[model samples]
Target: MVLDAIYRGELLPCENNMEGNGRHKQAGKEIEQLLKDLRNNLSEEDMALVDQMLEQTLIICDTECSDAFQYGFSAGLLLMQEVQEILRKRVDTAAHGVF
Candidate 1:
């Protein structure tokens, strides 16, 4: 199943397809401003260290977002399965003329 493929890490999530709302844009702007401040105030060596730190943070965030997406997708599939089971039960009951 496609879900199994995803769970097995065979299918990769597309990060580019993820869209954000106004709050995301605002937060990005805030981060940009902070980075700008750091660039202006910190020494070259310190800025290099900050850049490395940011690179690591980006990796962590990317991993977290991917995991969250997979988890939500799995949850959605389970919900759909539950709905289908409920509908099947209803159909069965109706066929038997049961209330």
Candidate 2:
């Protein structure tokens, strides 16, 4: 997937988000670091799960969103879902480890 290539540092994100609004000046570097950090912190199995979730979420966006506005909303929802799921699992893990 192009997204996976971008995630894996095989591609850059829009040449530093040069043509986009509300994008960081160093968005590409930021994403690269973000992926690196994630790899460092998450186990290989968990990382694969996260990657699968991301792909599934974007697949939903491809089918469900008809316009840029809707696509943005879909993507945002996917992000929220990803964050919430990760946090929920973290909480569950910590809770279990404490007992």
Best by TM-score: 1
Per-residue accuracy of model 1 over 1-99 as CA lDDT, tens digit each: 988987998666564353666777799899999999999999999999999999999999889988998899899999999999999999999999997
Clashing pairs in 2: none
When summed lDDT is taken over every stretch of 10 residues in candidate 1, the lowest stretch is 12-21
lDDT of 2 by residue, 25-59 (tens): 47767877887899999999999997898799868
Candidate with maximal lDDT: 1
Worst 10 residues of 2 by lDDT: 12-21
Cα RMSD for candidate 2? 21.4
Candidate models: Cα lDDT each:
0.89, 0.76
- Residue 60 in candidate 1 has what lDDT? 97
* lDDT for residue 72 in candidate 1, whole number 0-100: 95
